[model samples]
Target: MRVAVVQVGYGDAEPVPERVERVAALVRAQAGHDLVVLPELWAPGGFAYREWQDRAEPVDGPVGQAMSAAARDAGVVLHAGSIIERPGGGEVGPDGHGLWNTSLVYGPDGGLLAAYRKVHRFGFGAGEPKLLDAGEDVVVVDLPLRDGGSVRAGLSTCYDLRFPELYRRQVDAGATLFVVPAAWPAARVRHWTLLAHARAVEDQCVVVACNTAGTHAGTEMGGHSQVVSAAGEALAMAGADEQVLSVDVDLDAVAAWREQFPVLRDRRL
Candidate 1:
């Protein structure tokens, strides 16, 4: 499978819709890939937490519409990155709060494939828990590949990378590909790189991490978007700037590695 990881900026300085449109056009231009992944909170800047409630949209709202259109035009599966989502009336929690930090997936036919809310909120700096609620479940979806086999994709957000258990659970659920959309800071670029590879090696799956580039609300982001193989080899990686890194990964490698190592079978839990 051919996968593209996009590393771009998301700052309060630019108009959200216009930026989304521009990136969509860029992704459409590179349409030969089977899956195109974008950075976290590509629609609205992740650091723009103050505007999340006001800028939040429904699942089928304008942003979703735009992504659907782009996915259909590109003729490839698109993981459009994270968005601020407002759940319906009764879907809100007991506190009556109704929003989530969510990621969406669309098929080549412009149909909605999956919606994953970030289960582990990033509380390092600004403390995401103060603004966004945690998700209740994990999302694992299947996408048909051109090779006549299907790949199981797992959804996760920025801070979720710090927690290996999440990826392990997804692997147990049969996910062969792990997708992480992040707004990782420049101060901790090493952590971003190391953790992504660790997750892939530990879980024996292909890991794709797409992160933003520019500064958002005075916080500089490390833009080294990367794709790691099941054997913990870096297949392709971007620099600390805006870029699109694409690489081909054979899904069968995951199975081959798992059979050779068999570490997963020794888990006592």
Candidate 2:
């Protein structure tokens, strides 16, 4: 499967509306790619905590609509990064906050394929934990390939990479491809790449990690967006700047690697 990982870079000076339009255009540019992935919270900004509340929208809000159209125009399965979701009807989380850091995927026909609310909130007591609800369910969706076949993709966000159990559960659910969107900071960028390789090696799944770039709200985003094979091979990796890493991934290799290694079957835990 051909994939395009768009590593987006934005700053505080750029308005959210212009950024949204820019990202949508970027998605539209990857016309022949089977899958196009974006970074986490690229719309509302990752460390722009103060802006999230004002930028929050529903599932089918402006960001979603723009992504849907972009996917349709590009004819690719688009992982349209993430958005700050404030659903209507006054729905609130256990913490009394109705906001959610939600990721969205769209089909070639501009249809909503899947939406995964980030389960592990990054901040311990402040940012996410204090302002957004933790997602309770794990999301796995079937992604279409160019060969008229499909691959089961497990969805997780930035901080979710630290927890192995979440991916273990996804592996149990028959996921072979792991889609991870991150806005990891430059300070711990090493951890970001290392953890991605670890997840792919351990789970024996294709890891498509899209991360953000540039400084925003005083935090520099780590921009090494990458794609790792089931065998932990870094097929493609971008730099610490805005880039689009396009590479072809063999989905069939997952099963072959699992059969060859058979490590997962020996797990006793």
Maximum-lDDT candidate = 2
Q: RMSD of model 1, in Å?
A: 1.5
List per-prediction Cα lDDT, in the order shown. Answer: 0.87, 0.95
What's the C-alpha lDDT at position 63 in model 2?
94
Off by over 4 Å in 2: none
In the range 1-269, model 2's lDDT, one tens digit per residue, is: 99999999999999999999999999999999999999999989999998888999998999999999999999999999899999989988777789999999999999999999999999989888988998889999999877799889999999999999999999999999999999999999999999999999999999999999999999988899999999999999999999999999988899999999999999998
The positional error of residue 255 in candidate 1, measured at the CA in angstroms, is 1.0
TM-scores, all candidates, are 0.96, 0.99
Pairs with steric clashes in candidate 1:
none
Give the distance in Å from residue 268's predicted Cα in candidate 1 to where it truly belongs: 1.5
